[model samples]
Target chain A: MRPVVPYVTAALLFGLGVYGVLRRRNAVLVLMAVELMLNAVNLILVTADTTARAVLPHSGQVFALFVIVLAAAEIGVGLAIVLQLYRLRSTVAVDDVALTEPPVSAQPVGRDVEAGR
Target chain B: MTGADLLLLALGAVAVGAGVLVVSTKHLVRAGLYLVVCLGALAGDYLVLGAELVAWVQVLIYVGAVVVLLLFAVMLTRAPIGASDDLDRPGWPAALIGGGAGLGLSVLLVDAYRWSTVTMPGAGTAERLGEQIFRSWVLPFEVLSVLLLSALVGAVVLSRPDIGQPAPQRGDTAGDTSTPQTVGADGVRR
Candidate 1:
């Protein structure tokens, strides 16, 4: 009964995090929201493992530790890329990035060369 | 309602509300702050579940490390601190529809699983968890360490300044790529 308390709370937290990740536009904030979601899942896993007899495998906590490490590494790489994007372009808006190079028409430089001649 | 139920409800409300605010707020920094509140409530929930080790890890990893990285990234990227003019997208209608469907599914799942009750074996402690981690999950744990190593290397590579570009002369320009480049109309090297 007491364990159910955490499970319900964790579920609600996970729901909210899902909403955030889906709704937010900022990439960094999206990552933060993702972290919240992962944390919520970790809470549920820990609670479930602790409360259940057969499911009470210690792997849940170990898996959670792995999640934390992975999250840290992800943030590091993600932020670096975002910073790079910000440097290359003036903004970090997801829509602003061009996955492929924008096509450009070659402008005639003959007139300027002729004038120089 | 029982004491446990009431407590859970209160904590759940706080966690949910804060989590919503983390996404809803336009200010990126403020959103990170709201995330902290949400995570802190989650740690509290972990405590209520009798998972002291997990609760501390929640505080250490999510509250401490992850959120700090988020704040640093926001600052480093120089994302606008004030409210963004562009908040919601035109696709919000589709998002609402999808969200509603997912919510309905989750509700159905919860109702279906309501009959299952969890029972603990003996007392679950950190020592027991450690024994299992080292004994059974040792291979996966080592693999995770390898993954971390790769990530560390990847981060260093990604953060490295572009090697193709010539280093900026000290008198003419700042050497750091973090600074914005100002191009002259004549296009002479800065």
Candidate 2:
């Protein structure tokens, strides 16, 4: 098979992912874009496993699996952060996730929303 | 063209088309669903390339778990089910950069390996891949396990707001365990 098809596909996928990340304001959407980029890289790795002659066979596939694992972990933590952001700020827009101090009106809430127990 | 070439081309088109929709769709839930389609089509591409293990892993992890988590997050954040005009920013710069990077990479790769046929490797089943991972790539695998563990801990901590907060004011939550009066209040809260 001609490998260029998958290669170009991966490139365009990564590019689309980049556009999503840059243009989207929703944090979840940005993470989804990042997933697109990661999947593109995984495609490249698996395709390279078929095309290249490495010292260790199937290394590309192995690495692709590892990348999948890494991405799972990333999504888990990323959504957690987004949830916490929503709890504090009431919005999941990426524009408002500043590292500065909390807003003035946010100081008086007494309850921990998640620590219900 | 060979059957494999045609299959790759077809699956690649599906994957990219779905990917565009994933990022560009107006409906938030539809974007997540479109991500499922895009990733599943990429899994198909992997199958066409003979990477069976990677394809299944992609389906299980990316399509199954990650998309579900994203949808849950969307709902949790109370994002509108219909459409939100504020989801996107100005796009021309993003388009310029994304298109430039993609085109540059595609041109480089195509020029490097234009019409050359790919030499198919050995069948990358779970058995052979496991051996390669355990025998040669053991250290990285172990480190990845540790990383997963840390991510678990970090996510738990980040999700809970009461984990390590100092008592800024005694009146903030008089429901301290030391006081029995607020016990009824805390009980009512729970």
Candidate 3:
């Protein structure tokens, strides 16, 4: 197969992933998008590895393997965080989890004073 | 086109189509299933490219372990299984960005390579992959193991925050006056 075919596929997959990551409000879907992007990269790597008839032909496959392992590790940690977030907030919507301080009007004066301390 | 080329094209189409479905599906569980299809098709692509070991690994790791873990999390978190109104935002910006990126990258790649073909070396066997993993990529392999270990620990810690915290004191009963335990939503004392 020509190399461009896989390259084009990877590019489209990556773009879809990027769109999902940006547009999805659910945290798990965002994580899924990230996985799609990683898979695209893996496809590209394997395709390039297959095409590159060099001294170390297996290098690209090895790299893809590593990416797989890393992806596993990443999803593990990411889902754990998501679970914890759900526990804390009772919801998995990313927009609701405001890491920054609440607006001044929304803050309780006593808690705000304690936080200042 | 040869059989391999045709198979690659078909699998690529499946993979890309499934990938799009994965991101666009409103049902969370359906999206996970679509991800399985996409990853499985990618494995088939790898097989067509002569990376046999990687293909199976993709099946074993991604389709087997990762998607299952995602589903477990979804079930555990009680994520909405059906369509969710808040699951997505306005589509235009994302579609614009994603489509533009894909088109631009495709144009660049086609311009760069101009349909040139490269000869594949040989089928990558498990034996050679093992040698390369142990002999040349030993450090990274070991490091990945370490990473997995750390991720396991982190996941455990994050999921169960009470693990390292001090246990309830001997006098801290539900009725104890000093502890001031509150009833949770499920009517459990906390």
For model 1 chain A, the run of ten residues with the poorest summed lDDT: A105-114
Point to the candidate with the largest DockQ: 2
Chain B TM (all candidates)? 0.76, 0.90, 0.83
**What is model 2's DockQ versus the real complex?**
0.80
Model 1, stretches more than 4 Å misplaced?
A2-5, A102-117, B91-94, B115-124, B163-190
What tens digits encode model 1's per-residue C-alpha lDDT throughout A1-117?
Answer: 455556655665566566666666567876876777777778766665665455436656666666777777788788878776675565766666778864441112222221232
lDDT of 3 by residue, A1-117 (tens): 688888888888999999999889888999999999999899889888977765765999999999999999999999999987786567888878888866663224333332233
Interface RMSD of 3: 3.3
Q: B1-190 in candidate 1: lDDT tens per residue?
A: 5565576668777887887788678788898899889888877766665566767877888788888988988898776778886754454753575356446545654665563545544434678767878888889888888888888888776655432233343333343344344333113542
Q: What 10-residue stretch in candidate 3 chain B is worst by lDDT?
A: B181-190
Candidate 2 per-residue lDDT, tens place, A1-117, comes to 899999999999999999999989999999999999999999999989888999999999999999999999999999998998788878999888777876554444425442344
Off by over 4 Å in 2: A103-107, A110-117, B167-190
| Residue pairs with clashing backbones, model 3 | none
In terms of lDDT, the best-performing candidate is 2
Model 3: DockQ vs. true structure: 0.49
Give the Cα-based TM-score of candidate 3 against the true structure.
0.86
Question: Model 1's chain B TM-score?
Answer: 0.76
Task: Give residue B149's error in model 3 in angstroms.
Answer: 0.9
